[model samples]
Target: MDVSSTLVFAGIILVLLWLFSVNNSSKHRLPPGPRALPLIGNLPQIDSNAPFKSITKFSETYGPVVTLYVGRQRTVALFGYDVVKEALVDQGDDFTGREQLPFMLKATRGYGLGISNGERWRQLRRFTLTTLRDFGMGRKGMEEWIQEESQHLEAHIRSLKGQPFEPTFLLGCTVSNVICCLVFGERFNYEDKQFLRLLNIFTEFIRFNTSTMGQLYAIFPWFIERLPGHHHTVFAQMDEVREFIKKKIQEHKETLEPNSPRDYIDCFLIRMNQEKDNPSTEFIYDNLVSTVMNLFFAGTETTSTTMRYALSALIKYPEIQEKMRQEIDTVIGQNRCPNMEDRKSLPFTDAVIHEVQRFLDIVPFSVPRYTLKDISFRGYTIPKGTTILPMLHSVLREEKQWASPWSFKPEHFLDQNGNFKKNPAFLPFSAGKRNCVGESLARMELFLFLVSLLQHFTFSCSEGPDSINLVPEYSGFANMPRMHDIIATPR
Candidate 1:
């Protein structure tokens, strides 16, 4: 066949596939959603920039549980805390499947804990959780790690001498170094060129993933991959990060001590050997490399971005910042670094941090879940292979859940007695068995880093608080807070 003939053939194949998908979906009592086109599905209806907003709007018309298609992929989005909690928390196992988006598949090459399902996911997740806990993931040892890192962060800021600087990469360095200490067993210097390069890659990775082009790429990767665009550049940079991880694995192997495992890499290397003979063992070379990549990527970007947003939030609401500082001074004083033990004594400070996470709603759409098999949810049949989206944004911002769903109010997490209160709907880390593995660590970092920063410096931008917008610049894959150059004046 000539090129034109081949193109026609491919087009016909896609039509047939889309028709088959529609025919099957019609057979089942799928949830109601907006009308969709044949090949493109509901793309025309969606705001490509903020795809979740489109999904949320669909829920307003179709009720809480609604279905839509994105480039022929059927998706059922659960809105509100009740419905999302029922699916992800109530029927957790059925919603445990992680959708391996083409973007993630390309990033991990189909071999990581972040984008795997079934036995692979279970094995790696169990092992990862166990190993991380052993290395003090959410425990006292990790608290010390964060406390020490806080000092380093504070020192770096003090060296700035109150000059205005964008906190994006500097905060990335701070957060990434903590995960580096856990995974690689060492921290990178703030000025390391390669370290800075890796951090930039992570920032770009999040930026692209949250862009409109990135959304299109996820929905129609087969077509997008064939065409030239920014996606290619993002993927290439991702490969560089992956290659960097592989090199680190090699170094760990060379310096391995079976009896004295230095960090996560050493521990995994030891496990890989113990299971080298077992065919079913998930502890293998590819998994180790990919899981490390998963850890590095997840452990670095999300927490760092949250901290970045937290700084923006603080700058935007200096009153909240001052209140938190007062609480910090009273509870922990300025003599020593803030610790997790100080959280209870510092209720207002704790409330502000929790409120920050809740208001930001960073991961608005929890990593899309997949139905591994036919399942019944809310009297509807979610057919196997359908993507499930528990809209964390709706839950976090649900009118019925919060007194001020849209505003940044620390009192949302506070009681009439002025003690810190826990809200079931405050799911910034999400809720479920498949929720963020690094939740505890992220919490520790936010508290320690923010408290430490406020202890020494008052955050304000040159453009003034009025110029700082708490609204994220992008709102798709993640809610990315607008970046600003701000001064950290010595307190």
Candidate 2:
């Protein structure tokens, strides 16, 4: 209680912290990587523009598991299927923590399902999956929603009358509408100004996250957030979406039914009331809003971007697209709407869709994981608090698994008999516990949307198939396919 006693206690705490850091740093045999400088720490060595390639090249030299320092943060990079699988699958328990990413932390304020760890994460993730499933995410009811949405998409595209138009917002509107139906309990019109603005904001948020500035913000957030930039704009834009979610939550509270919850928000509100008397419940206002934002933010752009990328792929490879159409036509014909059941019957179409996802490698740097404690991986110890990149780009493009890892090949998912085959390394949704919860929904969306589009129209670009580039226009957090204007000739 005395001044000297207080000073002595503080001294012991600092000493313990110092000793912990020193012991972890000096004793642990870290994975081999480029040596770091004092403060910069390998930032100079990493290619900011195409960091994933730089990482892949680094893995080639340093082996599958490599250590790198982005800013002062000590991070481990896992490359290839064996190393990534070994950590994410075999060592799943040791690698379940999601780092409090500064960008996401700023947006969600560490309240959402995505940015949470431990108890909060477990609770939110369990509740989110159950709530979403109950509302027909990846179920027959949801398939009906997507099927109806596909008809709207067909009409929207057909209204273009075989003329050229950018499919970015079209894909976004269509995709966001599905999540809207699930979360908000209603779909927004494709031409709604507010809805379009929200979609644009989501698109902008993703673009910023995939830019050099976005990576810089992640590394130096304190400085980045202070300076004038689009990060502020992105945050403000996110506020609009959050405010919109809040408004929906209020509406749900006004008319929520106990037994018949309509959507994700409604179910969450109902559960919040159920857990109101419980002291340890995670069902509060902050978690509700953030979790809804998590689902809406995640469910929208990733699948839409992948769908847009598939359009590019289809445009690039007309023969493959045409063949897929033949398979679709044979399976369901142009009149009937495609469903999840149709996925099996239409093997070639399924193969093409899978190939598009595999080739796109959307989230190249799977949201970085954190070590729960000092964990040993492949004879190397990743220190606690270290950011871990499982490098999904490596898994999706690992040469050991895929025959042609670099090329866009539907045969990658096809057997010699042309039946759809599943490869263990096709990990666009990633693997293990923290793998995408919306995997089933995204898969269903890709199949139903793409099949429906191909059923009605033939996709083509003014520049022709030769001009269609499959390479991503940007690559940092996500590998966004280059945007293109294409015409759809109604079949």
Candidate 3:
């Protein structure tokens, strides 16, 4: 253990790390990128606060399809509308693989539809979509559930009587209840402590997962796991959510009616029974628990977060809020409940909602895709096991696709006639084979809930519209809006 001996050991370690980087980098016809350092790779070049911006910057030098390393993980980021669409839409079969992010893998214990691949994914996705459709995910039954929840939401806000309140958990309760109706066949009262506690856990879990520490955990999980931080607590809280889902599943099993399924759980349980004889069937206890967790997690947060951000955007631009209200008043009137059928008639309102999603740019990195096998895309050989990121931020804000990509302009989604126009780049739900399974459900919830709120009340905060910041509080994993207190005055 002399000084020279220690120096020899350190030299050997650096050499091994250098060899590792060379093997990953120089082995294939990988897309061009900045020269990565050993072990840490291109992480030093990335901005922790806005990693998407850093990745987009790489495209400036490396072109639209660029390869870079995140710690030891090799990532291929697709930028701009053309590159992303070409990879995710044109050659979808190759780009359809979902990256089983370490945080999510640990959360779901590698069993849910969110991170599963191949047979498990195909079976669960198909069955889940079919069951949801049968139970009216995008249909009249689902719309009714959202409308009912909107009534509860309005009543809760009215109880405040224009007193300023933070809408974070309130919006969470409203949106989560809609999913509860679909998945658990019941919705809890807003005052239910257990339900409220679970919602709080979800908020923290997402915050941690999108934090710099969370990104670090994903990059160097082996090292980070050995150390200590909030990651452990996040996983433990996720277990609590899973336990809640398990309890609901057990209740559904007790009340099991083979002939008639009451909700998503009932439908899944019935399927489990039908597929019991098959050895390879994906319907089982683990898949059931994890898949329900997936539905609950995905269904609850994104739509609710979008609505929360929408309110902030409205407060930031009161003119937009007033315009939406004027349109809603004209199309549906104040007395009638908003429905999906009314979306077409309320074009300006629809455009505003669409603009909110585009402006918020949640899930900017979309869920990372993986290469199941070596493949040629855009003349680059993307090696097997490479993580692919079709940056939705790039598509949503690409200059070629959006006239004013950086601005909060509802006119982006409107024609000269002011009719709601469709833009190919408006991909808040993402696109391609692995796009969000809950897209239809989310769209229904956003349209109905927002319209219902505007129909009943006008949203504003105490600090005035000038003080409101439409920019997100956090921009990694998902763009999390900053929480604020706002008044909801009855119209």
lDDT of 1 by residue, 1-491 (tens): 99999999999998999888888888788989988887999989888778888889998889999999988889899999999899988999999999988888998889989989999999999988988999999899998998888888889999999999999999999999999999999999999999999999888988888998888889889878999899999999999998999999999999999999989999999998998899999998888888999999899998888888888888889898988888888887788887788888989998988888888888889999999999999899999999999999999999999999989999998899999999998888778899999988898888888888888899999888999988789998899898899999998
The residue ranges of model 3 lying beyond 4 angstroms of the native Cα positions read 1-18
For the record, the alpha-carbon RMSD of candidate 2 to the native fold, in angstroms, is 4.8
Residue 456's lDDT in candidate 1: 88
Q: Residue pairs in steric clash, candidate 2?
A: none
* Runs off by more than 4 Å, candidate 2: 1-24
Give per-residue lDDT, candidate 1, residue 415. 96
Residue 205 displacement (Å), model 2: 0.6
List ranges where model 1 is wrong by over 4 Å.
1-13
TM-scores for all candidates?
A: 0.98, 0.95, 0.97
lDDT of 2 at 430: 83
Candidate 3, residues 361-454, lDDT tens digits: the string is 9999999999999989888899998999999999889999988899999999999998889998888888888999999999999999999999
